[model samples]
Target: MASGLLIEEGEKMRTEEEMFQMILEIAKQDERIRAVYLNGSRTNPNVKKDEYQDFDIVYVVNDVIPFLNNPEWLKKFGEIAVMQEPNSKAFGWGGDHNEQESYTWLMLFSDGNRIDLHLDIKKVALDRYLEDTLTIKLLDKDDFLPDLAKANDQFHWIQKPSQIEFHGVCNEFWWCLNNVAKGLNRHQIPYVLKMYYEIVHPQLFQLVDWSVAQKNNFQITTGLFGKYYEMLLTKERYEAYLKTYPNPNPEAIWQAIFNACYLFRELGIEIAESLGFSYNLVEDQNMQRYLTQMYKKENDK
Candidate 1:
């Protein structure tokens, strides 16, 4: 539709069905394309669709060499605005052996639709994708693709936490407060930011993730790094969580570090109580006081 994808039969805009028909039509023309499938968010039943969601397609073929070398085949799908072929020499691919059997084409169409298409050698490696719960088979001529046990969101569900694991996070959260103070005192942004993210924030997110897991009886996901916190968290708790983010200035960063400590202490207590573990109030109080003292001294200097 952009320029050369051939909006065939006098169609102006290429719709979803039309795109699928175009993909399948190309596969039908070639004997090598033995199977067709879809993966990623497009196959996830829970995910909401928008114009930006990519059409993740996989073509299981007898061979991948022709598709690898030929650039003409790509234009058939649509006028490609931009294309990334990862395993190609032109794209900094190592050599022939690295990707001899499989290849990838991340195509962006002119009409704002994108498709991440992969061409793989049939039978040997294609079965690996069939097992993933977030996949749907579009076509299989010779019954090559296997039957999955069941396709569901079980792959991302939250797992139960052990006491040792739980304690480790609480200890890690309180201990790392010193590092952030040290970074702030030294006027080093990297150290402060790193300690906050790699040490402090993981625990913050983990506590929230644990809270969600507890509320849901460890039966659901918290998304990738508590992205679904708003959905699962109470409005009051969520509003408090929002106050923890601070601007990059020294004073703001100082306030943010304390905010994080308070939030973590609150969430950690709830989670520890729920899990029947002891929450270290002594460590929390000691760390909070130490952080305040360090911040005050740094400002006085």
Candidate 2:
């Protein structure tokens, strides 16, 4: 049982230091928890640190059921903005039903801080947990945990697309754009947005990502949704990329689809040339022509 030096409620928002102390205190009080560790962005030196980054914590306990049963125990951390027990069978998680292997409680506090906590059962073995390069041991009472390797971004580093991956992404992007145009004509706003954002945009983004990676020798990252893309992108290409997200109006949506098509075409070609992978230019041309004709037909109506 960990000593939750319970931070009293009804006060100013708790700081990061207070949060870590409270977490360590909880581990200290509970003899059942033999060790603790941190993971995710917190341990990655490559990433610029931020307040919103999750405190990816792991509590190595001999048994998991007691903590699983007692959900209220988490209230000690702070005024919880929100919390989720994602791995529980009660939550309908499919695999191992969050078995003794490990379970999780992802939490956000009112103070604008979040702690993504995992309770890894001791019986699962230390070697399994150490596999993630983004891991750091916080506390080990019984010396149950071992000296893990230092954290690295190896797991997340951008990888050069294989010929199959490059070809597939190009095929999917060009193929899905027609769905957006058709949805627009049918006044299926949601459907069009879904096709563009969910289906086509990912591939477009990936193509642009490949362009970035091609320049950097496929080593650095652009982060989620190209948060770091601007720093890496040529000014002209980045501006064109920004315009791809248009207003929900049908005309704007149509234009944005064309914008994305042009960007993807050039980027895909560049990536293909650099990587020596084949590009589906004919499919790209056919889709562009189809979109142009569709736009004219819809306007004429």
Candidate 3:
């Protein structure tokens, strides 16, 4: 089992209170930086503290031109072990959404803290502010920011899916499960699990989360491996989900593969029913059973 080293290290890296103080001290003298706000795990109380926790910060700046031109100004925060400017042509994973005018900097530090700094000339703050749910006003020099309520996880909440969307996820999950079966038959354990994890499992878990989120008002993250799922999920159901990953033997692996098919079929049906979609569990179940039988016959031969 791969231990969660990234999350554990992030908790040990820095104190939130100290980081807040440092940001405030810097903002006091820097006239260009008019306001400071935080986002991501720092604001999320439910998230466990770790060194990998990013400081999702935004600095509402004055001109935003001179600083954007020279990225060195950011080094004042700390000796940057390494960094990324998402908007830069050299590294444009997230391209400039606005014409050449609007600029945002997405940075990851060596200490494992990340900051997504958005630069605006103060004129566009109001319009941009209303559009995003996670925007929190920390310090506003001109008192332009409204008296906002405490931050909530509403932005990250699982939205209720449409019938079409629910069915689409189900279709994708079952389709990918066949790939896992094929990989396992070919003695490719990595290929089998990769498909199982990335495609099939995510769909199953997403629906489960969506169902729970609907019940609880969408306020939690289940973590990557359903790490926090036990809080919301029954122990029996959670254990059942775990059964989908059996020991990696050709004979024993089929039982696990079948369990995945069963679990996904059940969950997908529930999700589809909730959204008023036609559940196709019969079709998926038959397909999964056929795949399992074929793999078993081939192994025997």
Candidate 4:
């Protein structure tokens, strides 16, 4: 007879119910584990449910050191395909790399289940639990978890931009393009792509989100990195947004930059006009001219 604690090998992907049961059973067996709760997409009502979503579980423990010292207990879930202990000294995540106030283990089982599990002392968990509204209590062995409101993504809502914020985004978009231009002109593909995606593109996307918010009354969630962009943007606007992504080649890269500039201009002006905010047309024109000269230079080479 197989022990209930050991998840059988070659088993099909466990259903949510099975996963939850196993999680609770593990907590129940370990007297050190005080309570268990869930966080992230599993707790987000607005997020579409999918098999790919991993369990983001947190266990409030009497003490974290025992769990940290003896991690072999996690094997009860299944054979670990891979795992990461972010708080471990090998990871050097942040701080002194040895701090153990709270610890996290992200694991993927051979049965195709992933769990990002955190162990925190009861005090540490209780003090910071309310900070993320996307949370749900799974088990409370001693009634340690407080009554929480229905889990929501309200904390992730897009906010209305102040005038200063508007100006700052615009300034960042235009100013950073110079770095992209210089990289492109020097035929430094890596530098150009890095600047385009990492530095410049985020500013453009922020403007795009703001424009969407302007139409939608600034009360929406674009779902982290604007994942909802395709759904939120109009067909024409979304198509334009796609053009901002460029291939590694010089011509394609340059064209993508032009495409980005065009989209930013149209959206930026529309937003400024609607909000009665100043749009620095002269600064925009000068940057456009600089981009054209750089493109011409790249072509001449």
Clashes of each: 0, 7, 7, 0
User: Which scores higher on TM-score, 3 or 4?
Assistant: 4
Worst 10 residues of 2 by lDDT: 1-10
lDDT of 1: 0.79
Residue pairs with backbone atoms closer than 3 Å in model 4 (clashes): none
Q: Which regions of candidate 3 deviate over 4 angstroms? A: 1-13, 45-52, 92-114, 183-195, 217-227, 242-256, 269-278
Writing each residue's lDDT as its tens digit, candidate 2 over 258-295 gives: 88988888888888889998888899999999999999
Off by over 4 Å in 2: 1-11, 93-96, 125-127
User: What lDDT does the true structure give each of the candidates?
Assistant: 0.79, 0.82, 0.69, 0.86
**lDDT of residue 141 for candidate 2:** 92
> What are the per-residue Cα lDDT tens digits for candidate 4 across 152-214?
987767788989999999999999999999988787899889888999999999998888888
Query: Candidate 2 versus the native: TM-score?
Result: 0.89
Candidate 2 or 4, higher TM-score? 4
Q: Order of candidates by TM-score, top first?
A: 4, 2, 1, 3
Q: Which structure among the candidates has the greatest lDDT?
A: 4
lDDT score, candidate 4, position 157: 70
Q: If both were scored by TM-score, which would come out higher, candidate 1 or candidate 2?
A: 2
- Candidate 4 residue 266 Cα shift, in angstroms, is 1.8
What's model 3's TM-score? Answer: 0.77
- Steric clash pairs (candidate 1): none
